[model samples]
Target: MNALLIGAVLISFSSVMVVLAGLPPEVTGFYRLTGGGMAMLLVLARAGKLKLFTPNTIKWGCVAAVFFAGDFVFWHRSIAFVGPGLSTMLGNFQVIPLAVVSALFFKERMPARMYAAILLALGGLYLMVGVSWSGFSADYRLGVSYGLVTACFYALYMLSLKYALSKDRVDALVLASAAALVSGLILGGLALAEGQSFVIPTLKSLAAISALAFICHAVGWFLVTRGIQTVRGALVGLLLLLQPTLSFLWDILFFGKPVNPVELSGVGLALIGIYIGSYTKRKKRTQ
Candidate 1:
């Protein structure tokens, strides 16, 4: 539980890092992937686990990489336009699409709670943006759009990665590094085409990027994954909620994101909805 708490806290800093880096979204994503990838690769090398890169691993890793690249692009753009709190919250909308996919393809039946959860979340979103929809800046609207795009891409990435992990005999760490490096290369190509410089301007930005790589990606996720393995299923959902919840708070505290009573209520409502949707009920066995 301590690991999970610390991990969530570190993950919450992800948007803070992106904001502080002050780089283009692609550039920020490039650094995050390459830096974190190389670090994880080194660990795998030290552990003599580099041989785990089966052909199956590479194939699925590439597939997952493509979706993740899309996720990074739109999510970073959303962060730039809307600030971290709302953008991160919007990304959590992945649950809706994921639930739909589960029902349609996997033939899994969603509980009544999921329908109510979706309504609650959408209602909260309406409060956040729909109320002042006409008055919002073009960039704000685009940010929200990018955020929803991020959710779709994020959901696809999660599904592909989950399938790979479940079916392949690859080490989780190896697959992660491969996906990161591949995605980083894709973003690198895009960055070059856009004529963006790889040169990070300030030392402060470098530090932020470094933290994004090592702390948020490498260490924080590692801890969260470890915690998930040992923790109860119900607790895992609640514990993981800490990441986006703190992210919203961090934006308010650090970036001075303006919020009113209604928006605040919306945040609370949306978070509750997300939590409810995220929780999977475990069935009991008959004796």
Candidate 2:
């Protein structure tokens, strides 16, 4: 049930990202996050769950801003370089680091059997790219680099948010809202420095980014936080594997992406990993 909900959220973002692929990176960055942040903020404010912004809240929130900003900028750039499917797969690798850090620092643990899941997930990502490594052209190379960077930044965002959520430092909704505003301002500056237009984004692009924010950032994070409180750390990590899976499906239907044998096998491996990680952990917990 929890897994299904996460998968549904993943599918929503997958479709949204396909739409966002056509927008300017900076514009895409702001719209993809800010609306959802505002929505969450509104709920928090009305509920009086909105905590006062503290120095520490500002610190972590600002860091989240930078990471969120960096993640989108580089991810959008990666899509421009590599195709969406490959970029999404690589960016999704942040799950590996998240699982590891949660185990080390947050005491999120699973049984020995869970190790196999990581390998399967990585294998899936490798296969998703066809594992050819042949066409490492300047664009592809740069895209890969940026994709990995996006993963790193995303991992940081996850960790920071996890800390904030655990501490109840501020309302999650408030934190999200402030982070988006900060990130929007930062990206707005970068767009200015790059001579990109910031005034009016296209209607199509606005719609795409609106879906990205409301569905992806706001809903995804909201449910993930709630789900994580109930599920195991490894299970939570594995559940997110849905994002890349559904994102690839969107690439095929929307962008005319065709899966080769290698790619299919790779995606299979990723799904297997998720099953191994999540199911095995669940069984261990039961035992």
**lDDT top scorer:** 1
Q: For model 2, what is the error of residue 180's alpha carbon versus the real structure, in angstroms, after optimal superposition? A: 2.6
Model 1 ranges with Cα > 4 A deviation: 282-287
Q: What's model 1's overall lDDT?
A: 0.88
Each model's lDDT comes to 0.88, 0.71
In candidate 1, list every pair of residues with a backbone clash: none
In model 2, where is the ten-residue run with the lowest total lDDT?
Answer: 278-287
- Please give, for residues 1-287, the per-residue lDDT of candidate 1 as tens digits: 88887888899899999999999989899999998888888888899988888888888889989999999999999999999998999998888888888788878899999999899989888888888889889999999999989988988888888778877656787888889999999999899999988899999999999999998988887788778767777888888888888999999999999988888888788888888888886556479
Tens digit of per-residue lDDT, candidate 2, span 1-287: 48446745554464446456466788767665667677777767787766666677777789788888888788888877776776777777776766777788889875665677788887877776537667557777788888888887888786888788677657666677778878877887887888887554567666666667777777776776567557765656556666676776777777787668887888778777755654523344443
Q: State the lDDT at 86 in candidate 2.
A: 65
lDDT of 2 at 80: 79
